[model samples]
Target: MGGLEGEGPDRLLRSMVVADSRRGQGIGTRMLAALERYACGHKVLALHLLTNSAADLFSAHGYSRLDRCAAPDSISQTAQFSTLCGSSAIYLCKTLSVGD
Candidate 1:
């Protein structure tokens, strides 16, 4: 899912999951692609997410590991950042282009 939270060039990629029974298929990737398209349409310049798992999947899709502190204030102030996800959660970001 996509969380169009905050007022900035970034959009939060809240969550993306494929059921264990549905794993190994391309559903998650397709979902991510669609989410990116939607974000691009909304003028989002980047997508960020905090994950303790699925880092490999995100990395495979071009998200790079980043320090959580590098997250913009718009992102860091969210409940997901401040309360939901733990301090050890991995932060990942992907810079987006208009047509991406």
Candidate 2:
């Protein structure tokens, strides 16, 4: 999908997953595309995620690693930031653009 002209729905994308049995069949990619499509419809400019897993996957898919302590307040103050995800968890972000 593409990016919207204004503000989008949610800024944070939490806990993306694929069952172990379905790990490498392009399902995750498709799912992510669908989610991005919806996000674009809502005009979300950038999306953020916190995870201890899938570093390479996220990186290859255009997400950039961010310092947990240096994350923006919008990201750092989330429940996943303070409680759900661990203190050492990796914070990553993908900036969405038109036609992206």
Candidate 3:
């Protein structure tokens, strides 16, 4: 499962999870794709995520690692960045071509 935190152009991708039993089946990839489609439909220009793990999964899907401080306030102000995820968590982003 996965979710986005805001409706604005810059949004946070959070709460992504796949049960241990569901690993290695491409479910996470499918879920990410769906979320991207949903975000694009809502006019989101970029997606930001903090992951201590799964960076490879995201990177493979076009997300690039970035400095946490580089995140826009719209995403930096979210609880995911302020409190939930730690400083050590890897920050990644994907710029989407809306309506594509």
- Compared with the true structure, the alpha-carbon lDDT of candidate 3 equals 0.92
Tens digits of per-residue lDDT, candidate 2, 1-100, equal 2222223333777657889999898877887787777787667778787778777877888989988786667766777788888877788888888676
Residue 71's C-alpha lDDT in candidate 1? 92
| Candidate 3 off by > 4 Å | none
Each prediction's total of clashing residue pairs, residues at least 3 apart in sequence or on different chains, is 0, 3, 0
Regions of candidate 1 where Cα sits further than 4 Å from its true position: 1-4
Structure candidate 1, residue pairs in collision: none
Candidate 1 lDDT by residue in tens digits, 1-100? 3345655698788867778888788888888899889889889999999998899999999999999999998898899999999998999999999989
The C-alpha lDDT values of all candidates are: 0.87, 0.73, 0.92
- The TM-score values for the models, in the order shown, are 0.93, 0.83, 0.96
Tens digits of per-residue lDDT for model 3, 1-100:
8899886799999889999999999999989999999999999999999999899999999999999889999888888899988899999999999674
Error of 2 at 70 (Å): 3.3
**Candidate 2 at 96: error in angstroms?**
0.3
